[model samples]
Structures are given as structure tokens and as C-alpha cells.
Target: MARQVSLATQLAQSPSAWNGHIAPLILRAMTDVYITLAWIFQDREKRTDEYVKYGLGQRKLWLEHFKRSLVERGEKEPEKNLFVKALTRQLNAERFEHITEVNVGAWSERSTRKMAEEAGCLDLYRLAYTPFSTAVHSMWTHIAGYNLRRCRNPLHQFHRVPEDSDLEPDIDYVYRAAKYVAKTFALFDRETGVSVETPSSLDQFVESLAHPTGEAQTDSPDPLDDL
Candidate 1:
């Protein structure tokens, strides 16, 4: 008879068996959260700019000066406020020059890397896991009409839901992307002597070198989508 693998044993083997799959998944999840937050902040900034430009109209000069002064003050002591810190660190001065030019996707990619650099691998791991967890929880909540926070394996919660449903596709895509990120990072860890296990395939190692996209599109959503 074959020996049954315990959860502990399965998890113990994961660093070697599933590192490749998990790395991308982590990256994908972080990307999603970063992109969503970027959109929210960018939208807010756009509305504020519009108000200053149009609402204030002929008084635009005064409004612009006030805005510039506010930004300068925020830059001088950004650490005093969390929002200012984020804006200064994530949204560079050049990018903030024109609200319309803000690309959440691009910003998220750059910000994530900056986070990884300033913090450490573990910090990046947390950033990736937190949003992925929230996304999975949200998916289960929508399908079961109840929270699935207590579930041992949130991924299983997805299986109980419909395949063609609105949230399912997103959940699946995020999960896959997270897996890819985890694998990539794990490989990096091993290469840098921070991890014990090494990746078996170079495919993930190669993929990590390429830039991440907004999201995986099964079909071409638009011709300019890639751009």
C-alpha cells in the first residue's frame, strides 16, 4: 500500500516540488493589489487636479502655486504622513507632473521592485501574500455567500464555485501568477544562498527576466492592450 502524505510532509516538500509554481503566483497577486491601489490613488489625484484646473478656473495660477507648495512641504517631510510617504516613494515627481500619464501597471511594477530593494525578500513575500489572501477570501465570499476565512485551503474554496463566473477567472489568474512569482523568488533565494532548495527547471528563471503585464488575457482584449 502507498503511504499517505500528511499535510506537514506535503508542505515540507513544497520548497523543492512547487517553488517554481509558487513564485509567479506571489508576483501576480502583488501586482494585482499594487495595480488596484495605484488606480484608486491616481483617480483621486486626477479628480483633485481637475478641480484645481477647472473648478478654480481663472484662479488657476494661485491654485497651481498652492498645489506646488503643498507638494514641496510633503516632500520636505514625507515621513510625517503615511500617504505622503507612499506618494513620494511610489509616485515619483516626474510621474505626478501629469495625472493623465499615470499608468498603474507600470507604477506597481516599479514600486514593487523598490519595495524589494529597500526592505528584503521576506517583505516582498508578505506584500505578495496579503493581497492574494484577500482576493481568494473575496472570491469565496461571493460564491458561498459566506466568508471562507476559516477554511484550511482557500484554493479549494475556488473549486466549489462556477468556472465561468465573474470572479473565478480573476481568482484563477491571480493564483497562477502568484505561483509564478513565488517560484521565481525561491529560485533567486537559492541562487543567492538564502534558500536550501534549487529550482529544477530554468523556464521560470528565464520568465522572471521579462517584464510583468497588467494581467493575463486568454484572448486579445484589444489591439493596443499590450501597449
Candidate 2:
């Protein structure tokens, strides 16, 4: 998580040449790191068989998709049946009859959101992780917010800005991402019996960004900040 956040910080600090395109990428990376850490912290013991099952299911799904595409393209001949062989081998290794078995039936109750809830970091998922997901998927929610201009007239008022006029750089986001990384690191450390030691400046930097002097921020502070 620390390394991922560090890379995002570097990208954010670099020239604003790709701010519009890169910011979302950074946000998604941060969100992934946050969720992955939360999962590790919440399921250290046996890591919840469901999570393992979910991962195996994902692998099976991809392999099955690949096999189907190969068959459709007429590339499933005995000599060129690499993907089919791979799928079969994977299923056999996992002791599953087919990909359908891996994907079907009752799944684990523990989801990404559930991990966050169990880890006491659901607010982080709600505030940042979910929004970042839309950005990652290029959903209309992200497109309409960042790409379209707001106007008074309801009809034909929205105009897409030129490529050159992309989003301005936002340093505040970098700070918040860093803070989330720090908190996630602490959570994992505490859960794993490791003492988290942040740099002397980390708390002050996060606080300064969170509450600029003389400005009242309504956002509730992270409880982990006290640590």
C-alpha cells in the first residue's frame, strides 16, 4: 500500500501533462491498495475460504472466457488447443469438474465491502473507494461529472471540453490518498501484531491538508488519526 501510494504521489507531483487521465488511475490504484489491505487485515486467519474461492472463481472465469473465444475463432484445433488445455488443467488441478462449478452455487458472504466493514474501514470505501470504482469503469457518473460542462439551460447545455482543457491538477487529492494509505498501513500493522510508526511529518501533513487554517471542514476525521 505504501509503495502504491508513493507512486501515485509521484504521478500527482509530476507535470500536469496528464492530470485529467492520470488522476483517476491514481485514485483507482489507491482504492485497490486500500481494499487489498483491508482484506488482509480482516481475514488473516485462513483468509476466509470464501475469498480464496472467489479468487479461484475469477481465474476459472477468465480461463473459460479464453477457451470460448478460441473455439469461436476456430483456433481450438488439437495442435492449437493451448487455451483449452490450460482450462482443463486448471480445473483438474483445483479438483473442479468445470468452470461452472467454480462460479455457480452459494458464494462467500464476505465481499470487498464486507471486508471493509469487518475491518472498521467502511467509511473509506464509501468516501473514496466506491467513487474511484466508477472512474475505473468509465461509468456515466464519472463521465458526466468530469467531461461535461454544467449550464443553466436544460436542453443542449452540456458541452464537452476540448482535450487541452482537461481537469486542473488537484494536490489535495494526493494528500488525502496519502492519508488513506497511512491509515490502511496502520490498520494492517496493528492487526498483524506489528507496530506502525509513521514519519514525524505524516500526521501534521494530513491534518494540514484536511483542515486548512481558518477553514471549517465538515468531514468527520478518521478515527485512526488519533493513533
Best by TM-score: 2
Per-residue lDDT of candidate 1, residues 111-227 (tens digit): 444434433444434665454454455554343542223445677663443332222222333334444445444544544567546553334433544424665565557577669
RMSD of each: 20.8, 9.5
Query: Which parts of model 1 are misplaced by more than 4 Å?
Result: 1-120, 139-164, 167-227
**Per-model lDDT:** 0.41, 0.65
Can you give the TM-score per candidate against the true fold? 0.20, 0.62
For model 1 the local lDDT of residue 52 reads 37
Model 2 ranges with Cα > 4 A deviation: 2-21, 78-101, 104-108, 139-141, 150-164, 196-227
Residue 177, candidate 1: Cα error in Å is 5.0
Cα-lDDT of candidate 2: 0.65
**Position 50, candidate 1: lDDT:** 46
For model 1, state the Cα shift of residue 96 in Å. 60
